[model samples]
Every structure is written in structure tokens, then in C-alpha cells.
Target: MSTLTTAPDPTSETAQLVRRARRHRSRRALRRTSALGLLLAAAVVVRVTLGDYTVTIPDTLRIIGGADIPGASFILMESTLPRAVAAVLAGASLAVAGGVMQDLMRNPLASPDILGISGGASTAAVFSLIVLGLSGPGVTMVAFLGALAVAAVLVGMSSGGAKGGTHALIIVGVGCSALLVALTHWVLLRADVYRLSEAMVWLTGSVAAASWTEIARLAVLAAVALPAMLLLHRQLRVMMLGDDLAAGLGVAVERHRALAMLGVVLLVAGTCAVCGPIAFVALLAGPIGRRLHRGRTRLVDIALIGALMVVVADYIGAYLVPGGGNLPVGVVTGLAGAPFLLWLIVTRTRVET
Candidate 1:
């Protein structure tokens, strides 16, 4: 019997590509979920066995799961859980923001804080505290808007240039960041002693005052923003291929960039609102995540890896020191990221030449 040959359907080809992308995402999700699980376990182990004073892992887990202990559960829920949640949310949010910035700006060094985005937020929040005497949700709202404003300015400036030169953007962003940071410092210096003390955690990127209020707010914002990023996954990937190419493929390049910038602002602002603009997670996460996943995973994967890193690092900070009180998670990440950043610059220059 003779068998007739059939032509492949064009829609089927497109559907296949879509299916492959979904499969890739699913695999990445599995890997990240597994990594996060391990991180949680490790965090618990580190917190219990070696932190402050030694407690058994089982006891720690019980404390975490809310079996009331005498004054222990109170401490864990009030202090430890908040800090842990802050670490995870800050890590994931900043990393995703950085990944988006890097892709949008076409610069490996691009980050949310790099473009004065977080600096703007920090500056605004500081102004609110010192000048307007604002607090609570008002401060957060102002910071969020400030971040968006900086992003808008950057996009406008970049659009004016004939070529979206990455170096030019970097230089401009650095200048803006420095100026805003200087202003923030000036404001802090002029403020009252108590206010300065209060702002110290923010200025230094500390999670020292992590609380349930901060956790709940950031968690909701992150939940919304993460899904938004996921929905734009394909658009972001296209944008990474360059604006001209994306435009040629019928993608509204400028519009997409604008949306992406909004995503970055939301991600970074929500994080800064809670964790006080923790440094380097935005700068380091994308590159580190790319390296960890062998450059195979998408931005979402990078975000998950970042979350795991922060959670793990926060656990170390919480438990590694001799005293019950620990350094801020931001301090630890900043220390770690600085050296890696230097290495990246050196390696990148060498490779280019």
C-alpha cells in the first residue's frame, strides 16, 4: 500500500513553537521550585543550628509553622518570618527588575538601581519622611511614583539618541543615581536625630526593621507584578533581540519598553518600600542567575534564582553571627555582589577585546 505525504500546517508550526516555549518554562519552573525548596530547608537549618543560640531544626520548623512556644513563636513570627519574607521578595523583585533592565537597555550591567530608578524611589521616600513628614502608605506611594518618573526620563533621553547606545545610557544613569543619592544624604543630614536613625536602615539597605506590615504589602505587590512579567515574557524576549528587529516583527518597540519600565518600577518600588532599597540584588541577580541556569532559562527563572539567593543569604545573616541580632541582608548581598561585579567588568572587557 502506498502512503500519501501530507504538508505541515503553518498554524501547527506556530503552535509547536508555543508548546516548546511552554515546556521550557515548565522545566524552569520545576528547577526553580526545587531550588527554592532546598533554600527554605537550608535557611531553617542554618537559622536553628548555628544562629544566635543553637536550637534543633525540628524545633525551628515547629516554631515557624506556628506551634506556639513560650515567647519563641512570637519572636519567630514577628522577627524571623518577616525578615525571611523580605529577603525572598526583595531578591525576586530586584532580580526580575534587573533582568528586564539589562534586556531592555542591552547592557549586561544594566539594573533597576543603575538607572536611578531605586535611587529616585529612595530619594522620594526620604523627602517624604524628612520634608513632608509622611509615613506609612503615603511614603510608599510617593516612592513608587518617583521610580516611574526616573524611568520615564531615562526612556525619553534614550529615545532622543539615534542609537540606543548602552554606554551612554549607563553614564547618564550613573550621573542621575549619584545626584539623587547625594540629595538623599543631604536630606538625611538636615533631618532630626530620630528621623535619621529611622532612615538609617533605608540608607544602608537594612532589613533590620522588617515587619508583618512590610511583608504583607510587598507580597501582594510582588504577586501582581510577577504575573504581569510572566505575561510579557515573549515580548521581553523579543525586545532583547534589539528594538529595530522587534519593530520589524510588528512589535511596538517603544510601547513595549514603556510597559517593561513600568514593570521594573513596580518591582523595585515595592521592594524598596519594604526593604529600604537593598543594594546589588538588582545588579547581581541577572548575571548570577544566567550563569547558574547556564544561560538557558528565561527572565522568570533568573528571578526565582535571585529569590533563592536572597533567602539563603538572609538566613546566613540571621543566624551566622554570635549575637542574636544580625547584620542586614542587604549588607551581605552588597558585599558579595561587589567582588563579583568587579570580576564581571574585567572578564567582559577581556572578552570584548
Candidate 2:
């Protein structure tokens, strides 16, 4: 009778484990979504509370709801609100771009900044300023083209390498970035003092002067690009399993990767054109989202985390600067992101060893 007993099938037990894992992941995603909503509410409160003349949270709510606060209306509408909106948009856009790139490349360190998107935009913007004296939309247009060109070069190089991998892409991007940085500095040194001042602002990145016009331009660009990004989300997850696995799963590996790269290029270009190579928002957001959500991360969560960080950082810079002049959010992000970058490098090296 004891010898007649049988154990459960191993495959059945494995399937059960997978189902449980999927359920856990789903629950985690939902909790993260709720947390993100709370963080967004907090960000709005903080933004409304900080300024030369702070508004009470209740009054800020009224103002945001379109009720007029006579003396504060102009400042709130024309300056603070627009700037806050820009920060939110820029943060979310960059973060989404970064998360997509990381997943597509299957590399923790992959980001728009790392992949030469921002550098490409910077090179073109600098050229427009120093060579053609172009400003406004013209500069942005050139920058957009530059980002496309650089991304094309990167993909081309990566595919042509002996063995295709994320490393090749990163290497090509880093090489291009190094060359572009040198050229940008040269252009800056050669420009007149006045133009140099303008270029300086572009290089440092600030959304302080965002207008309805600028926001509209970004909105239009995002309208075309955002949906494209969302379309790639599932394919991008498949892509994380490597080209062979993705292909086996019915993904057109090369085609999807190319299209995904193009989408990120458009996103980075659109944001960089308006905000001027915002430094570390892209680099930091993906990890922050992962940390917040635990395990797998969603595109929306990453975007929300990025947006929240940028707004909070801007608020900090506005308050911390002794003379009341705000530090560019890019600079603040760079400072905060450097340590994270260093840690990634160290951990990566240890893993390799």
C-alpha cells in the first residue's frame, strides 16, 4: 500500500509556481500604481506651496481648479504652473524613453543619455547657435534631425559589429558622444559672448521659461511619439529575453528593435529640444521606478517616478539657492545620478568577476 503512492508531476508543480509568480507581479503593479497616485498628489502640493509668495494648499487647489486668485493668478498661471508642467512632462518623457531603452537593450545601464541621443541633440543645437545663429524652433528642428542621425549611426554600427549585443550599441554611442562633446565645446569657445550665454543655458538645461507655445510644440511631438512607444511595450518586454528568444516568440527582432530605437530617438529629441539635454532624469528614473515597484516595472510607473523626481528636484533647487536663483534641474539630477551610476558600475564589475 505504501509503495502505491505517487508524487505530483514536476511540470505541474512548475506551472503552479509560474502562475503564482504572475499573480504576485500583478498585485505588485497595482500597489505601485496606487503609490504613484499618492506621489503625484504630493508633488502637486509641494509645487503649489513653494514660491516667492507661497500659496496655502487649499488656495493652491482652488487656483489649479481655475478659480481666480487675483494677485497670484498672473504669477501662478504665467510662470509657476507652466514651469511645473514642463518639469512633469520632461521627467515623464525621459523616464519612459530610458525604461524602453533599458528593456530593449536588456542592460541596466542603458539610457537615452548613454546611447548618444542627448549628445546628438546637443551637437546640433550648438551648431545652430554658433554657426547659423539659429534660435527657437529652428534650433529645435536641427536638433531633432541630429538626434535621428546619431541614432541611425548607432544602430548601423551595432548591427555591423561582429557579435551583436547591447555592449556594441553602448560602445558606439559612447564613442559618438565623446566626439560630439568635443565639437560642442569647441563651438562654444569660438562663439561670441552673447551667443555663448545662450548656448550655456541650452547646455545646462532649464524649463523655467516654458510657455504655452513650447508646451504645444512638445505636445504635438509627443502625440505622435507616445502612442508609438506604447505600441512597443509588449514587444519590448519580449525583447528583454534576447533576440533569439524574442524571435522564437514571433517578434521580428531586428525590425522591432529598429522601430523601438526610432521611438526613443523621437522622445529624447523632443524633450531635449525644449529642455536642452536634461542630464540625469533618464538615467535615474528607470531604477527609481524599479525600486518603487519591486521586481518588474511598468512604463507608466517609470514615467510617474521620473516626473515626480524632476518636480521635487526643481522645487529643491528653487528653495536651496541662496540668491533665490534656481539651479537648472539638469544639474541637480546630474549630481544625484552620479552616485547611482557609480554604484551600477561597481556592481556590474563585481558580477562580471
Candidate 3:
């Protein structure tokens, strides 16, 4: 018995390699995640402390630590800090929303903006501002409702099963985007000049007026929506291997997919409502995250990259732009993202879906 030997399973080598590859990918994602987090932290610090007013690091820390140091406190806690925090939360929400959209549509170019989710929110937000004379949370609530309505329409129209559903969804999304754009323009055309300027600026997106109350509310939204998306990640990954295979593996593909979409819609609406639809944070973050992770998207990486992107963009818009007036963060993101979008279209010959 002692002298008898057993052979390893025939598939052991392949299984081991697969496991090793997975581990490598996980480690790589972890590295990038950490780097992204650090970068985001640095960005937040810079945004909070190094603006034109230039709050010293110690005073900034004290301000964060709840010191009421007169003018410094007002600048730090009321203005800079809230704006920075809002940008981070909004960015993370948009990025995670993008990742979910890509998974659902199976298209790398898919995002809240492209699918008209942002358009819906923007339309409602502008209407509430100019037509209804609503401001603050009222506009945000309208935007969220508008986003949900658009997402529901999309899900309803695109549930034609897997074969042609994706294509139909893409077509419908583009149409929705165009229709929404026309509607937005029509609404704007009817606006008074004074309100039109306000609407235009809001549509361009700015975090400068971010209030602590708004930040608190967005933080709560993030706490719920982000976790929900992350919880569905493994399920979504399994579902990627064809519907039949996913069903065989015991995933309720339709249910989970719908759930994921709900989460995505919530996230997109929350961010758009809070800051208007800051363009391209959702579009760019997922692909960059996937490239860094060397494969499928990691929600954390996507979130971190997105947060950093918006924070940096906001910083530029807020302080670094040539004009003394604060530039809208949306404008900055549009400027940075347009070239990248062109590059993506030219380079990516075949989109998976």
C-alpha cells in the first residue's frame, strides 16, 4: 500500500493554469485599484487644499476635524470640501453605472449618456429649472424620476430575448438620445433669456455649488447603489457565457439583469440629478478600468478612476481654466473625453455585442 502511487487527474494541469490566471488577474486589478484610490485621494487633497484660496494642509485637516476657524472653515467645509466630496460620489456613481450598462448591453460604447438615461435626467432637470421654476432637491427628484422612466422604457422595448435584443436596444437607445436632445432643445428655446442661461449652465454641469446636504444625500445613494451593483458582479460575470449556459449554471439571467439595470439607473439618476450629467465619466471609466485590470471590469477600479477623473476635471474647471469665472465640470469632461471617444471608435474595429 505504501509503495502504491496515484496519478493526478488529467485535467489538473489545465485547472491549475486557469486558477493561476484568475489569481493573476485579481492581483493586477488589486494593484490598479490601489493606485486609483491613491490617485483619488491625492486629487481630493489637491481640490480641497490647493485651490486659489489655498487652505494649508493643517488648517484643512483641522477643518475636516470639525474646527470652526472662521473664513477658512466656511471655505473648506462649506465650499471646497462639499464640492470635492460631491464630485467623488458623483464620479463613482457614473463609473459604476457605465460598467453595469456595458454588461447589460454587451457593448463597450454603452453608457448612461449614450443610452439616453442622462438625457432624460437632463431634460427633466432643465424643465424643472426653467419651466416649473423648481430648484434644489425638487429638480433632483424630477431628474431621478425622469431617468427611471427612460430606463423602464428601454427595458420594456428591448426584452426581445438575446439574439436581436441587444441590437434593438442600441437602436432604441440612439433614438431616445436623439429624441431627448431635440426635446431638450425645444424646451430651452421656449425659456426666457435669464432662465435659459441658468439652464444652460446647469446642463453643462457644475459641482461648485454643491452643498453639504446634497453631498450627504448623494453619499447615502452611493452607499446603497454601489453595494447592490457589486453584489451582482459575480452573477453578471457568469451570465456573460451565453444565456443558455448562464441558465444552466442556475443564474436567473432575466431577473438579475433587470436588477442590475435598476441599480444602474438609480446610480445614473442620482449622479445626474446631483451634478447634471457630467459627460464621459461613465463612458471612459469602464474601458480604462478594464484595460488596467487586463480583462473584465472591476467596479472598484471603475469607481476610483471615475472619481479621479471628475475630481481632476472639476479642479481644472474650478481653478486652472484661464477665465476667472468657474468653468463647469461637464465642459471640462467633454473637452477631455471627445478626443478619447474618437480614439476609441477608430481603434476598436469590432465591438463585442
Best by lDDT: 3
* C-alpha local distance difference test of each model: 0.78, 0.81, 0.85
After TM-score superposition, what is the CA distance of residue 232 in candidate 1 from its true location, in Å?
1.0
C-alpha lDDT of candidate 3 relative to the true structure: 0.85
Local error of candidate 1 at residue 216 (angstroms): 0.7
Better of 1 and 3 by TM-score: 3
What is the alpha-carbon lDDT of model 1 when measured against the actual structure? Answer: 0.78
lDDT of 2 by residue, 1-353 (tens): 36776888999999999999999988878887888979876886677667787777787778879999987877677877787888888888888889888887677788888878889988898899789988678877888898889888766765522156778778877888898899899988889998899789878878877787887888787778777787788887887776677788998877887898888887888788788888878888887777776646578888888888888888877777677677887878888888989998898889989
The segments of candidate 2 whose C-alpha lies over 4 angstroms from its true place after superposition are 1-21, 61-68, 160-164, 293-295
Query: Residues 1-353, candidate 3, lDDT per residue (tens digit)?
Result: 37978898869988999999989877877777788889899999999998778899999888888888888888888788888999999999999999888877777777889889999989988888888999778887898888888888777764546446666776787899999899999999989999988778878877877777878888999999899899998898987776678889999978887898888878887787778889999999999988886667789889998999999999998889986588899999999999998888777755533
Measured on C-alpha atoms, candidate 2 has an lDDT of 0.81
| TM-score to native of every candidate shown | 0.86, 0.89, 0.92
Model 1 C-alpha lDDT per residue in residues 68-175, reported as the tens digit of each score? 777666666666656666777788889889988887787778787777999999999889888889977888898999898889888887673425488888888888
User: Which parts of model 3 are misplaced by more than 4 Å?
Assistant: 1-21, 162-165, 350-353
